[model samples]
Target: MKLEQVSETTWAIVDASTYGNVGCIKLPKSVIVIDTGMTPPLAKKFRKLIHKEVGEPITDVILTHYHSDHVFGTQVFQDCTLIASSAMAAIYPELLNNRWSPEGIQELKEYYVQNDPAFAEQLKDLRIITPTQTFEDSMTLGKENEVHIQHTGGHTAGHSTVYLNTERVLFAGDLVFCQQYPYAGDQTNNPLEWMRAFEEILKMPVEIIVPGHGPLCGKEEIQIQLAYFKKLETWIKAQLSEEISLEKVLQTVDSSPTPPYDLKADPRLKFSIERWYTFYSQDEG
Candidate 1:
């Protein structure tokens, strides 16, 4: 497994193409894993990587959400408690059973075959897990070191973030994507509600952020993302007040408020824009 040392205590084994991002957080009581990459087979290999890095077994596996990429690989650890948000555990089975998402998934499968054929073979029969223990708000793991996992679902209904209080590192799941546009195509996506969720994340006192898809970033990057979301909300509110048609909003708004939003250049932007118009207007009415 290719590992990137994101911070002092956090390491990311990222899926370069698509469908993977597994992080390991070393806490005082024990090492707590953030996400479980692709499948049970990959999870076994991930164990070796973790043992090599921390020289200890993963005491806990905390899944940030129920998306296929993040939660499929939970069988590697021998003696660890698997965790998922209460909301995630509730709806996880449905997402796993329906395997029609070839677009995002193909990216990872193609890459894994070339880089790690053994792992690709292992991901063949996937195992989806329900949280052994569930929490409504925030939860902590490895109390000696203090890893505070904050639960704020958006992007997916049970998405979560993990924080190391001493290290001040946050493992932000699908709540924020790095270079590409976020997928808000699910039935659970609520654009305006997601906007409110972003507000809560901005209030976190964090120094370093390990996003679900990209490299670790600073608090300033978080501010920029928050600002982008704030602009989106304001723009939507203005359109509603002006009594403008949803079509106009869809045309005017691009990927984001900034110049590079380039709705025409990226196909994914259409879905995001449509989601915004449909969701917010319904809320307004």
Candidate 2:
């Protein structure tokens, strides 16, 4: 993992060997973490690093969503106030009883062991720590209200973004995938809401964006992602008009117009396309 200073009071832990990206905002008396790393060990190390670099107690850990990559590491911050959108918080019980159950976790570790033994080992003592506090639409933090967390509902029904009011920086969970295609295959993913979220971000005074993945970027990346979603929506609408089957549409998506980003072979391409196609199909039906 690498830490890059974003602004006067903001910093991001980018290029994590794992998938998710996490960040922090330095406040007067304490620090607020954006998202925890992908695992307990990673988050433990991150906690230490934050203390060493910022020299302040971590008072709050704000989660952008309930994805394991972003919230799995939250175990290390159990002592702090863990926060998330009410919609996200509502999913915890189901996730805990199902995917995050001991049996389910064992299955996940076994699956990862074949591909990444190191990460699997880290999951040996894995535990799911749900948020203690929840917010409906938006919440403000800091004595001066410097941090603002808002529900955007795009990548997932409970997805959100954290904005540093004074810094003009946005911690855009999975909403903006900097240089690569995003994973939009979540069952609750909504292309229309995602597009609206992008439009809202574009109107912000944001000068810097800490994406859920990839290196730090700016509003240009948001514009690219928004345009890509618009293009995909247009294509899906045309296919629906022609009465194309969802399966056939997925098969032919590869031949559709190329995205603006150069990573055409991104593994997430097909997953995103399938989900968006399904969403549009159901809507049209």
Candidate 3:
């Protein structure tokens, strides 16, 4: 876990030891945290770090999406005003009653216990904290409204990006994966919306970008992701025209594209391909 001062007013945990990056925007009297870490303990430690480093009381926490990696640690900010997109907030009830329920959490812990015992330990006393405030499309925070958060569904239906108008920094939460293959297997992931989100980010005068994961970057990275997704869309459509079985299509396009990205061994590669294949298949049907 490394904390980097992205700008005069913004700081980010770019190299998360667990998963998902976290960021905060320091205001005159308060600080607004962008997504907590992957677990309760991690977020608790991060909250303490923010208070010590930023020297301001945390007033609000903005959730970029509903993924466990980005949201499960929200319990640390229960005292603050937790905010999320309306689409994201709506899913919390179902997630709480189902995937985040005690039984569901135990099942998750059991799975992790086999794979990552340390992480499973972190989930021991985990608690689910839902957003207290919701936004429709876009909203602004800060005394001068310098913080702009907009819902740009792509990676997930409720995914959003936070931009600092004055600092020229963009906190691209999972919308931009710096160097690795993104997890596009989410049920709500949409290639088209993802591309549009990239386009929207390009339009901003962003000097720095704090991606949801990986090192800090700029618009160049966004362009690369956009181009990659466009190529993926084209390839998927071409494959569909052949009317071949989905299995055959997957087998034929097993190799990852190179010029832009070479994430052939990335675990999410095949999963993303399959999800995109299913999405296009259903659309064409």
Candidate 4:
């Protein structure tokens, strides 16, 4: 795990060179970790890295969403209060334990371990972790220090983020990703709603933003991400008017908007485009 200084109290643990979303952050009064890495070994390595850097254990662990990649790491920080959106907190157990899950990520359920040798043995033997506390829309933290935790759901039903009022940093979770187009596969992903949340983020006087996956970013990146959502709106509108196919839409999209990365191989693009189309088409219907 590599750490980056976003601000005075804000630090990010970058997991790998590629798909570096497996990271966390430390605040002044309490430390808030973003998504846990995809498995136990990665999570353990992450904890060691954090302890080495902060010189103290994690006081709080926030799982942005219930994806196996994110939640499997929660077990590593049992000493801290496991936090997540009420919706996310509720959905994790069945999703983790049951052979069948709604998201249908059987490959991640079955073969992610194979892909990452670290996950090979650890994940198979882990126990279920249901969050002790839950919140509906928004929550606060560091009351003595006036820190805030905001829930801006869109990517998933229970997707949430942390906003540290002190450092003016926002942990965007999966609602906003860096560089690549977003993954909107869940039933709760409303492009319109997601776009609004993106817009709302602009209202905060945040200096830095930490994403669930990828690098820690600044204001310009936030605008770029918001623009991506807005572009989806425009593209989806074009599709509805012209009755274009998904492939045609892809072809029409030049420059890709997802810069510094080739999103063609990423499966998230297909689902993201589909969700974007639905948001626009629903209005016509």
- Please list the C-alpha lDDT of all candidates, in the order they appear: 0.69, 0.86, 0.86, 0.67
**Backbone clashes in model 2, listed as residue pairs:** none
Task: Give candidate 3 regions above 4 Å deviation.
Answer: none
Residue 220, model 1, lDDT: 62
lDDT of 2 by residue, 60-177 (tens): 9999988888988898999999999999998888887998888888899999899999889997778888899999999999887889999988898888999998989999999988
Tens-digit lDDT track of model 1 for 1-285: 676777787877765422567788875546788888767767777777878876575678898887767777775553678877788787855644555244435656667789998777766655445678778888877756378877777677777788887777778887766654566656666665566766766676777777777656666655665666667667767777799887776677553466123324566555666666666777742
Give the alpha carbon lDDT tens digit for every residue of 109-176 in model 3. Answer: 99999999988999988888889999999999988899999999889888999999998999999998
Per-prediction TM-score to the true structure, in the order listed: 0.79, 0.96, 0.96, 0.80
Worst 10-residue stretch by lDDT in candidate 1?
255-264
lDDT of 4: 0.67
The worst-scoring run of ten residues by lDDT in candidate 4 lies at 14-23
Query: Which pairs clash inside model 3?
Result: none
Rank list by TM-score? 2, 3, 4, 1
lDDT of each residue in 23-119, candidate 4, tens digit only: 4555455566666766666777777777777656467777777766567666777778877778877776666556434344454446756687565
For model 2 the TM-score comes to: 0.96
